[model samples]
Target: MKNAFVFLATGFEEIETLGTVDLLRRGGIHVTMVSIMDTCEVIGTHNISVNADSLFKDVDFSLADALIIPGGIPGSNHLNDYVPLKELILQKEKEGVILAAICAGPMVLGGLGLLNGKKATCFPFFEPTMTGATPTGNGVEQDGNIITCKGPGFVFDFGLLIVRNLRGEETVNEVAAAVLAPGY
Candidate 1:
């Protein structure tokens, strides 16, 4: 089974984080919600509290097929500022694991130079932060091992894209159809 880790920081966008988790779980992926904070309980930007599956320091991330980052104000910033997470991200990149981010979350990859020469997209205002990337402004953009999505509005598409990448187009179709998502 393919396993993925979704980082949850305090100020994360609830929909982008949880929606993607839901979609991936529906696609038969094992998704682990990881909290960057010291505690397992995380509070979103809108005051929604969620209990993460594990703390950042507790997991053996070697089993991760994909590392997902969801965007929101201080959440994205917190993700960017976490040294251990940044180190793991770089290591994952070297190992050719899939990396995905949405909205302001791509800035973390951009800041780390992972997006260099890659076509990526993020929430419009964060485009300038993607220093070495060519911002596509698309709802979703996938370049090799990296995938980026615009914002909360595209959470389903973003999640579906990750599913398509990790599984296959056939699985994407099945998941989409199961959810009654139009234009799949």
Candidate 2:
């Protein structure tokens, strides 16, 4: 149960949404995609209809070892609109669970003031949105258990980094060699 939970909303960036989950699961994490809606269905900004593993209410997110939010205009906005998603994000942080956000996703955490003084990195647009972040220019930044990545370009690195941290370097190397060596 290394992963425990992974949240995906409508309008999510296809790359960020899928890449991270795939990579982590390759490293043997138990990732679950929670939809923002009742039905386990979400349409990405690209109009890609991705079926989720469960409804947002169906999952006891508090049991998760980590909470992930992918970035995309509709995806992030969709997550913002869902009170349960926001609540889970806040509660995960309050309980000190590992919270990972990428691109605009960090803004969601910032809005809740979970990122004050933390070294965080997100898309250029989210810079202004982050009120109290250190604003690291690095492609990825991990502040304690909360890890943040830039965008889709860094999706592979973000996913691998988290897996390396959670599952150790050996599993990370094996997964990278097996899954990332060839183009997906």
Candidate 3:
């Protein structure tokens, strides 16, 4: 089974983060919720607390096929500030691993120069932060190994795209049908 790592820093968007995890899990993907913070309980922007499956330092990312980041205010900033996570992201990108982000999460990838020469999309206001990429206003945009979505409303598409990239179009179709959001 394809394994994915979803990083959760404090203040993450509860919908985008959990929705993606739920969707991917339904697709039969093994998703590990990783806390970039000191503890496994990371609080969301809306004050929802979620227990992560593992700490960032404890993960063996080398076995992961994809890396996901969900966006929310200070959460995105917090994710961008972590040196180890950034290094792992860069390494994953260089190795052609699927990198997915939504809302302000793409800004984190942008700051790392990973969006250079690619087409990306993020929460409307964050388009400017997408450094060297063409900022498309589409709800979701996938440029090679990188997949970006606009915001909470597009979380399903973002998750579906990630599934398509990792598993295939057929699996995405099956998963989408099961979720009643086929091609939405």
Estimate the Cα RMSD of every predicted model relative to the unseen true structure: 0.7, 2.2, 0.9
Best-fitting candidate, measured by lDDT? 1
Off by over 4 Å in 2: 181-184
The per-model lDDT (C-alpha) reads: 0.95, 0.82, 0.93
Output the worst ten-in-a-row residue range by lDDT, candidate 2. 175-184
Better of 2 and 3 by lDDT: 3
Off by over 4 Å in 3: 182-184
Sort by TM-score, best first: 1, 3, 2
Q: Which scores higher on TM-score, 2 or 3?
A: 3
Over 38-154, each residue of candidate 3 has an lDDT whose tens digit, in order, gives 999999999999999999999899888999989998999999999999999999998899999999999889999999999999999889889999999999999999999999998
Candidates 1 and 3: which is better by TM-score?
1
Tens digits of lDDT, candidate 2, 103-125:
88888888878889899999988
Best of the two (1, 2) by lDDT = 1
Question: What ordering of candidates by lDDT runs from best to worst?
Answer: 1, 3, 2
TM agreement with the true structure for every prediction = 0.98, 0.92, 0.97
Alpha carbon deviation, residue 180, candidate 2 (Å): 3.5
